[model samples]
Target: MTTTFESAAKNIIGAGNRLDTLGLAPATAGNYSMRLADGSIAITVSGAHKGLLEKKDIMRVDASGQPLEDKKPSAETLLHTVLYEQYPEANAILHSHSVPLVVLTNYHSREKFYHLEGYELLKVFPGIKTHDVRVSVPVFDNTQDMEDLGEQVRAVLKDRPASSAFMIRAHGLYGWGRTMNEAAQVVEALEVLLSCELETLKLKKR
Candidate 1:
């Protein structure tokens, strides 16, 4: 069920377009990836515009996120690799710096974690079947050090066995799933939830 290089590249391109259309990806602010048939990862190249991605914008990388092709992998490749390493079933990862996520995380006081609860969309995540469940989306302070950031993410994730996604304070959200399509769905659902949370805050201010 692993994807081919060409298939992965196409998926990345299509995913970029879809995310862009949804306004989840602006400028060069997002990265996409898929696990290839050979166990390698096909990911968007660093500095490439997600909305207008081409096949050449996608490059191959090792499971450790090392560049297997001439092009450099995304700067947050380690984040993607760490998730893939931790979750054997995760075949794709998508990271997006959306307005709602950025604003929400930035405005919230620095806290241990944020709770998302009572949303029907919660079912979009794995394991949960009811809207009554609660999920914590850990938000970490933004760091220039990918290794340090990745390690922090790993530590936070270790505490939540059922977490499907997380957010980077003042940055964006990261989502993954068993397949590229499922990963896209997870990202979309998270984005919608974040948007809803933002709107709720607006109503509270009224």
Candidate 2:
């Protein structure tokens, strides 16, 4: 079913509040978006705190990331746009700066991807029926240039079509799904897994 801009905006706002409650968004540290009925995208505006997002905080943009309205779009809008381009079924994208993501990405040393396996939560992601499945979440170096970062992400994802999410080293996580609810679920599930991994490492060190 197609969603209107008003409905999409409400969804984005509600998602922001929910993520904020989970401590995933802090100090305007995240952005949210949803695909509208008209093929255009409704995304959070730049500098609007996700925790306090309002209808005005959501704005329309073309598939190419050009703003359809007067509001300025998020700087990382290209990242969301690239996902939409790659996954035609994805209607919502959520990016969050959480402690678990930052700590885990910074703590890891030798890997390009962090693997999450053997957890029942692994099934929270799409297509996985059992915990035996392994999921790799790619970690890319953080960059100030969103364009360059977007290009890097697009290149990395070119062949790994099954990837549902990724992380920016010392930064945050990006998760997407077919709908806002699904997207939110993925983000929450990944965050929980990351936290578990971090706690496991702490116990190992002890």
Candidate 3:
């Protein structure tokens, strides 16, 4: 378990560096986690800039998001925990705050979902054999109440395909994968897809 925690922590730190370089985790705005061998999760503690994350910044929480130690977990701890519970095979989860997702989600404030279809980049997600179809990314309302927010997320994601990314209106996005590398890939792909959608909106307005 100790080794699992250490390895997960290092992977998170590396992911933070990559995400930081892409301007995904600005300030202290995102959280990341990996499911440990013992069924607990190693997550980034609250208030640390992801770009500067160290192994010490990672802490443990149960599968239900209960803190295992004195250190505080991210406010979105429940969010990550829920994903783990929802998908037993998903070992890693990421929540990134990027401008493109925020802007695009808010731009379609009344719309409950964002559609990214017919793009070759759609292949970036798993099970996408081709770009001939559209994938709907859920856009949820944001709130300070974590539990309330979590329930909302649960409902929205319940019927859709499991483990694809979901967004919070004017907030950010959450994605999970079987491994840290795949989770990071999901984040990067969604980030770029959101940016492309936002750019298209600008073009349509012209």
Candidate 4:
């Protein structure tokens, strides 16, 4: 069932709080959304510090991402909409610029894709039941133009759909799920694993 604006907003606000606590949505640097029953999107408005989001901070846009309210949506609204269009089962979308993710992606700049494998935490993503699995998170160079960037993202995922999340090199991660909880799970699980990977790199240097 499609979620309601009120319900979606509440979860998104609460998600903002949770993400803030985990250092994921630091300093107004992230966006969250849920696709509504009426085919509109309930998303955090642009420039709001996600950590302090309120019900009013959430706004709606049409499926094509045209604002349904006076408020402007996130600049990457097209990115979220593209995912929704491609994966009809995805209801919740998250984008964050966490430090570990940024550091890891930046350090691996030459690698077009990063691999996540052999971690039990991988189970956090749907359809994976074992730790002995390999998943490649596509990494795209950062871009300012949303239209061009969104199309690039669409092409990457279309060519080989991401299992749960994708990374914007030196930028952050984008993840979505069938529900808010699942989306949060993917974010949290990825956050944990990325931190671990970063630490491993530090240890290797030591």
- By lDDT, the best candidate is 2
Score candidate 3 by lDDT.
Answer: 0.87
Instruction: Tell me the lDDT of model 3 at 142.
Output: 90
lDDT of each: 0.89, 0.91, 0.87, 0.90
Clashing pairs in 1: none
> Model 3 segments beyond 4 Å from truth?
1-3
Q: What TM-score, to 2 decimals, does candidate 1 have?
A: 0.96
Q: State the lDDT of candidate 4 residue by residue for 1-206, as single tens digits.
A: 66999999999998899899999987889999999999899999999999999988899999999999999999889999999988888999988788898899888888878899999999888888999998788888889888998898788888755467888988889889999999999999998999999999999999
Any runs in candidate 2 off by more than 4 Å, and if so which?
Answer: none
For model 1, the local distance difference test gives: 0.89
Which scores higher on lDDT, 3 or 4? 4
Alpha carbon deviation, residue 193, candidate 4 (Å): 0.5
Instruction: Please give each candidate's TM-score.
Output: 0.96, 0.97, 0.96, 0.97
- Candidates arranged by TM-score, highest first: 4, 2, 1, 3
Tens-place lDDT digits, model 2, residues 1-206: 59899999989999999999999999989899999888899999999999899898899999999999998999999999998888888999999898878888888855789899899999988888999988998889988898998888889998877778999998999999988999999999999999999999999999
Ranking by lDDT: 2, 4, 1, 3
Scanning candidate 3 in windows of ten residues, the lowest lDDT window is 155-164
Each candidate's root-mean-square deviation in Å?
Answer: 1.1, 1.0, 1.6, 1.0
**Model 4 alpha-carbon drift over 4 Å, by segment:** none
